[model samples]
Target: MQKQWLKWFVVGMLVFVGASICSRSVHADDSLQRVKEKGVLTVATSPDYPPFEFQVNQHGHAKDVGMDIELAKQIARDLGVRLQVKNMDFNALLVAIQTGKADLAIGGINPTPARQQNADFSQIYYYGGESFLVNRADAGKLNRQSALKGLKVGTQTGTMQERLAKQKLKGTHVVTMDKATDLILALKTHKVDAVGVETPVAKAYVENDPELKDFKAAYQLNPKDTGSAVALPKGATTLQTAVNHSIQTAKTDHLFPKYLKTAGKYMQVNTANTSMWHYWKYFLAGLKETLLISVCAVLGGIGLGVILALMRLSSLKWLSWPALSYVEVVRGTPMMVQVLLVYFGLGVFINIPALPAGIIAVTLNSAAYVSEIIRGGINSVAKGQGEATRSLGLTKADALRFVILPQAFKNIWPALGNEFISVIKESSIVSIIGVTDLVYELNVVRADTYRGVAPIVVVMVIYFVLTFTLTRLLNYWEKKMKHT
Candidate 1:
């Protein structure tokens, strides 16, 4: 039985390693086969841009709805699988494709040289022109291309508009944001003098809100319609062919014009779920996800942290060196970089969903800091404590487990509580890769309400209340531990 179990373990490891190698080393016709086998097609999208892609209510649930969403669904149907949409920032979309996290990505993504280098492109599914989105006050003043010089103009990062704005409006500082909504906020706050967005999206925004009532397109930036296409991973020839066929079929069936009309109908606050109660649901869902991830990450961190701390304290060079190396690497990098690496870089091998990948990344990151916290707590114990344990004839392991750990934990409990609070805040980074935490859900609310600042300010208050309450509770717990 022991031999049989060992044989099975070896086989599983081999299969995992083989799959990882195949995903990284080759880009064959295997994409469609893999999707069929999994029974789901993962599509990455930035849903803040409407008509092409944006959030809408369907079956009492918020879902990506637009021309691209339907096209992605059509492709999934063609392949005989369920469709799963992963919403994130526009820049992260190509990274998702490169890392095999998504079968394909769609937004208002253009066929640019830099993007073409990283991924494959499908046939153009939609087209729109570029124009300036300015504050109502500045609408008349910044009417021409020459008017933008020396002023700050905002666009979504890594987008064709940024490059175009740079070329056409020489001397203008082109500030970039991750999403269109963020750019809206930046423009609203007067961070930039003007923003260049696709003509339809800009018009939709100005028409939706009274604050933007005076806001209008200063002038058309580009005369020709810029084409939007579906993006696939590099060398995904077969999948690209499949996606192109889906687009052609939709166009032939006259489905795109109907999709546009359907999407346009979703552009108002008079719809269901626009009430305050519905917005609260978004906040509550986000809060639930944030707390859940933080608790799981902190628990895992404590377990692994204790082991790592022990290793670092060990006299053996082998154990201490590796633990030290891991701590340094994790602590040296920013939290967002770690999340990206774990979600995309490590995703090259195994198929990791966003939630588990987020937990694992958070766990690994938290353990590094937790290890140092624990080690400091342990060191604060007198040297005589270990000596006294040994004098009692207890084994070193038993002494550490029974005598040392209990006391060390008592000393470190307050720090552990603070770490929990820190994790709660840090978990916001997980939303970048589409984990749908508090920040991600709030973003959804902003999209639904078109009241960006209110949702952000409200969630900021929610986070502050949570951490403040947790801190007060920890202070009380620490005081009680001392009395005991």
Candidate 2:
């Protein structure tokens, strides 16, 4: 009878494992096959950006227009695939392409050395230079770069302007905002002394707004400082070649310049004199902040999750109930809502000043999910193991600690790893709450430099690196757990 039970148990386990693996494999194969069979190329972009990929009401149907959008449509048409534009955040556009979620990212990306490592690029589409926006009153006082010393200079967190401000103007306190709109607000509110941004955007702000008319471009950024190009996912040579040829054709047909003219209208500035290299440093600086947010959120979430999980599983009803409640509430609501509540609502209601609301919200949200994972793990252990310990005269608590929880943890580790991967992606939502995470950084870079696509590509590569590393680590742990 004992041999029969053991044989059946082993067979059941193998079946469960095989089913899980097969399901994942099938999903992967289907996605790839669909792309080949359909022959429709999906291009990801951020439609919110003007002159790049902003949305237009064409007979009440939302259509995207801008330099990059038009360029991508041309490429898709030439390739004989129905062109599909997938609207997403500027930062997420590149990730979509890199992860095979989209065929390409043609969202006004600037080609940089760092981005080139993970993605191929088309020839330069347009070029623009970085510049600084300062109050009209301060403009005359700060003509040279040295004038920014000791002032609070604000830039979109991950942009060429931020990097250049940090490197070129030393001893200045740099406050990194997430978007051009926020940076402009900061400048108007006197939250910062100056804003370093791209020339076209700076000119647009000054010319478009009556209030901003008081702000002027104190200096035009040097030409060796900007660039712009389309991004293809790493290993997508076919797509890259197609995109390059399309760009050359667009330029020859005057389509590229015409699109730029339309895009330039939104910014209230001409891009004819914009240099490609001027924005490079800003993109690199923003890239660093994006990486920082992802890493910090993961570490914070894991630590807080373990604690919440333990509390939820505790014998004490008071601890368990509240922990369980927290988990339920956080898991039940949208992450975006939680971020806004934590950053804007809680701060307003409690009058308690806190760190960036984004970090706190992500940590709290992670803990709740982690608790359920722990609860499931604890429940999965065989009841006999605990009963056997009690028969040996060991206390219930001692048995749980010494015999049951360890094995239970091993069983749930892979699930925990999957959760970690989710947390990495979900961290992007923190940007909506004004965190200069990867997504926010990309927006800043795009708005400031007008290199819409490159910054998104850079952020995407960073996310891929992070998630891929986590996956490898999870696999290693799974192997070790199985061995033990």
Candidate 3:
């Protein structure tokens, strides 16, 4: 058994490593051609920064707006392709390019030396100033870089500001978050004393809210590292050249300033009505996707779980060992990591969209736990039930199918219901991959409104309503099954 397990593990590892190498070697230089062939230029961005990239509620739908989005449009037009924008966490933007999930990433991305090692970049499009956002009360004290000693400072993860905070601040505690909205939330709640942000972003936040203020803080920066550029996969010289051409044209036409002006108009519209009711469409769209993923994942998980449970119960080692290994491995890993691996890692071989990838990952993860519940329920059935079915001359397959599975399902229905409920809640993690689930829309609403806690409270209430309603239905069903 041990040797069989070791053999399977080694084989799995070899296949993964071999696939990774093939994927990299196969797609390294075809980035530009792929977009032309597909007739669509896919761009990935994190839309939480106002002037650079953000979302706005337009006719009950969230639309990507801001200078980065406008620049993406110009690049797509320059390439003679339609533009497809994907929203995700900022840190995942470059990964999307590297994995072939996107043709390029443009979310106010700074082309620092360290970042250049991972991905290629186009010519700089815009140079943004650096500023810090602090509470109106502390604006007097934290007005300059020197006053930040012993203070807690927040910065967006995988950003130039994060590097600046760590490298420049001598004694301040640096806290990193995945979203700019989250960092602002932290700063507003006093979780952090100050937040490092782009000068325009800081000014935008201060203008939208009375309690926030922006101040310049001196930090030595390389001139080359201060401007925003589009990121492409390493070795994608063709695509890099094309994007640089777009940037150059935009600069020559002075389009960036116009893009910023357009973005400002959308920002005004976003802030004009901060009520949750005005943005109900965003939440509704998110709820629809969340329920779709959860329903599909639950149904898929149950079907696969039944197969895996039966395999583990089989007498043949060949059938049982692999099933056992899969369950163990899946149950041991985190769901967030699994979602990323499925979306980005599997993306190398085939281009799977974010929504389907999220569903598949959740289904696979749920199957492991669901199979265990089924196995336990099967084991708890009386031995006499199997004997009686056999004595009645039913075949092994029919006996298990007609008699065993029914009873096992009845016994495990409550557990299955609990798993389903858990899926609805945990499915929020898919937002990290840009699935536009409730959490994703929550962040968008927060960014659009510039009111951190309100959107959070609204999303929390929505999740409660969903889960609470699900719990009630589950309890009712469990009771009905018992009575029957």
Candidate 4:
């Protein structure tokens, strides 16, 4: 009887283990578990495009106050989770979904064939018409695509309008901006001949801005390309199905128009009259990020720069040649190009946080210059110093460590300071990829307040102050070090 009982117990344990193994597959595949675990559904967006997604001052604070915000909130509410918005460049939104940085992406994103390859799309949540917005003075002459030949046109990067502009208006130079707000500024400043965008957004800018009176929507795009859908990470079918159901529910309830009407009220409210002190928070937040990236980049650049410098200075042709090539290539290109490549191109393959990626890109670009600076500094040191170190019975590594780097750094220190300052200025480019630097926040403030020039001037003053103060201090430090 005891032997029989033991056999049954063993059988029961095997059955339980098999069931557990089966259940593991279900939990591993369930993407919704994360939403429940975290209690927040993060949606990635670029909120500069008003009415769809934008910021507005709420009781002395900037809030995600737009149609998309409301729509996302509703979806979150339906899922019994809190809503969190991650603002970034529209071009980066799909990348956010693909890398699982954001659970969902909704920014009036039209489901395009190219984007579909990278991620899945929910059902269309909203439909909007595309139209040509041109300078009001030239509206009559440049209304048609044929007339736009040879003129520069602007569109938000990675958008359907960009593709359509390329296809329909072949001769037009399609200048891309990362945000709708920037495109509007480009159109206002005559940087672009016209901008092609969704009709409602074009209408919002024209109606909201007194200066935009000179811009007019020329004509509508084709009928077939108006659907805007939410994007989900690949293999997130369960979450995608839930989002599609929420969107369908919103459509059935006429939530789009209702959200737009409510968002319009907030969008038009002039927050310029509010205490400028209230908006200081945006700059403060930006300052923190700017410092973070600049400091981190400088430190990271120093480390990598040392490595590259040593490689370039090596006796071996193999080591020196590759390092030389890398420095030349990086130095030859613009920092902006490098940032885009790392964040967008390499991001497709690697998990890159916007902050770390920005830091990494800046460090890489800086490393090239830093390497050259360090190499120059090292060469400036006397050849006798190396001989002396070797005579002291030091290894090559110990010679570099004890006798070389200390003196090289002294010579390179001032140049490194200038590099740091240049980095602080160059850091502005990272804003395009959604780093919450001063530029990014100002972009938000400009759209939210519609007082575009003041926000820009303010940010410029802040940047100038930051750079100038750092320059003066660096100069003082150099002078004091000379005495030492």
In lDDT terms, which candidate is top? 3
Per-residue lDDT for 89-180 in model 4, tens only?
Answer: 88778866765568999989887777887778888777777777777777678766677789998998888888888877766799997777
The TM-score between candidate 2 and the true structure equals 0.50
Give per-residue CA lDDT, model 2, range 409-481, as digits (tens): 7988988888888877887787653354567545544453344445566778877887898899999989998
Taking all chains together, each candidate's TM-score versus the true structure is: 0.90, 0.50, 0.96, 0.81
Location of the lowest summed lDDT over 10 successive residues in candidate 1:
216-225
User: What RMSD does model 2 have?
Assistant: 17.1
Best prediction by TM-score: 3
Off by over 4 Å in 3: 1-23, 26-28
lDDT per residue as tens, model 3, 57-175: 88888899999999999999999999999999998998898888888998989999989998999988888889999999998778888888999999999899999999989988999
Q: Which stretches of candidate 1 lie over 4 Å from their true place?
A: 1-27, 57-60, 213-225, 269-275
Q: State how far residue 67 of model 1 sits from its true place (Å).
A: 2.0
Cα misplacement distance, residue 125 of candidate 3 (Å): 1.5
Error of 3 at 455 (Å): 1.5
- Worst 10-residue lDDT window for candidate 4 reads 213-222
